[model samples]
Target: MNIGVIKETKTDETRVALQPFQVKVLIANGHKIYVENNAGVLAGFPDDEYVVNGAEIKDKKYILDKCKLILKIKAPLDNEYNDYTKDHIIFTYLHFDENILPDKIRELIKSGFMGIAYEWVEESGRYPLLEPMSKLTGYLFAQKAVEFCTKYKGIICGKHEDYLKGANVLIIGLGTIGLSSLKFCMDNNLKISVLDKNLATVNIRINERFKTNKIDYIEKYSIELISFNNSDPLKTKAELEKTINKYDIILNCAVRRPDMPKDKLEYLIDRQMIQTMEPYSVICDTTACDNDLIETCVSSEEVDKIDIINDVVHYSCDHLPSIVGKSATELLTSQTFPFILEIANKGISEAVKSNKALYRGVVCYKNKITHRYIAEKKGFQFYKLSDLV
Candidate 1:
């Protein structure tokens, strides 16, 4: 397979999909890698190093056209989308459900290319390529949330700016992303309130014997800190509204695709609207499909919510791992090394069969999209992997 690596075109994207050392591993497995010049520059993997590691140093356009498989940190922006082909297998944290997928992405899916999403590929409960960045995004979201909260008045900060001492912060969701935010938020010694839709999960948190309690109080106090499930949106919204008014910051760690409840949520949002809560109120979501967050950043000639919430910031809807530069690259290597080997030596078919990979097209060879989320979005069903087998 002619594996290709391209410099990410998504604004603020400093991470590369393939690091030099990782490329060398694939190369040793009889796979050819074509990397764009300076592809890994932001990640500290210079073009010279790629050449030294036996990767072909090619231009962006050249590799995209010729490679059998492609690795990208972000969905292609407009310009790059026009040149995308149909035969390449594109791999990355594709936020397709968010509808933030660029037009180029639609073209790639329609072109019948093999698309593998790192975020969806879970192995032994770990998201292979996306774990590192997800962890970073969760941590970074808290830091940025603190910055955004300063716009509001009277957020409990002890001594300096960035030090959030005694503030009410709510992180909804206890997944990888949520826990990550909780770690940073707790480290800052802030009062936290968390929520998830799982009742069983609620028991796990409040259950004093939840283990790991000796080390972290956030886990200990989570039970007592006021948590709720999504059983009742109106009541939940009211409870959340009260907390939002009381807290200094709100970090939305939930990973829900925001398409299903437009009217209901809009109505609830209106009911819970608390503009009088000062201008410094910060709301940050590390969730991928931040449609509401994106909606918060717009305006129009006729009607707009432009000035609705001030000082509120959405975690860079773009990939945040890229912002940390080389650290992001090192993290990418940690993620891609295993997957690259599986693809090079064993083939994508085997990888997907192992339930450790997510595929794009020809899901069942029954002519239907196979991935559950994609199928849900496109109104298709999960065809049997065995049918393809």
Candidate 2:
């Protein structure tokens, strides 16, 4: 099997999909790896490192033309669409739900190429590929909150450094991102109120994990639990408004609304909702893409900075993990390398057939949409990979 590692071309994207060590492992396993020159340089892996590890550093054309598996940190950019074909396998963070599916994705699907989206790859009902980045995002979420909150004099009234103490924080989800943010909040002595539809499930899971000593953060942080009817957003909004004004910062880590027409924006935190927040309050969205969570947050690409709308500060940068490039690359590679190995060893068709986790990650295969959510969203013909296999 021949694997290729390409440099990320997205703005501010510094992480590489495969590190030098991972490349070495593949080479030792009798798999040939072609790494683009300077692909890992941004992540602290020099060309010499890959050479020493027995990876061949090649030009972009050679890698895209020859490799069986194309590894990447982010989804391929629009210009790179021509590089893929039916014969190539793309394994990356294909965030279809992050926003409307681009024409490039449609093209790949139409071209009958295989795409394995890391975020959709689940094991035991948990997103294995997304977990590492989620944890990193949470850490960055806290940092961004602190930076913006202090700079704008949003949360703390007194000394900037002491603002975290007793500051009120509202976290919307109880998933990995929410949990990670809670940990950082606890460390800063912030008062936390968690709102989740599955409040009972969260309580039970946290208590069980804490009792079993499974999570250090749970044991350390004391949280106030708030339950709301997730299905009823208006009711939830009303219930939240009663206390939302008191929170200094609102961190939305919940799943985003499905992609819709660009003209019609469905927001989790809309303009009317932010009106309740105190002046200069911060809204940090870890699941940042469009205005799905933070209504005022112009696509970070459009504004290139925080937007002050309705007197509340909004930050929604999609690629948060890339800020810590080297660490993120290492974490990403460690978690995803096994799946890559499985596909390389068994081949795409056989790997999907044999590995349930890998099969769940397959978004598109052989011109068929295998992911139910994506298919439903895009109006594509749905066929379960399991059934097809």
TM per candidate comes to 0.80, 0.88
The candidate that wins on TM-score is 2
lDDT against the true structure, each candidate: 0.62, 0.79
Per residue, candidate 1 scores C-alpha lDDT tens digits across 242-285 of: 64666666666665434436554443323235463445666555
| Window of ten residues with lowest summed lDDT in model 2 | 155-164
| RMSD in order of candidates | 5.1, 3.6
Relative to the unseen true structure, what is the C-alpha lDDT of residue 307 in candidate 1, on a scale of 0 to 100?
A: 36
True lDDT of residue 298, candidate 1: 25
Model 2 lDDT per residue over 136-170, tens place: 88878877886787788544522226433556788
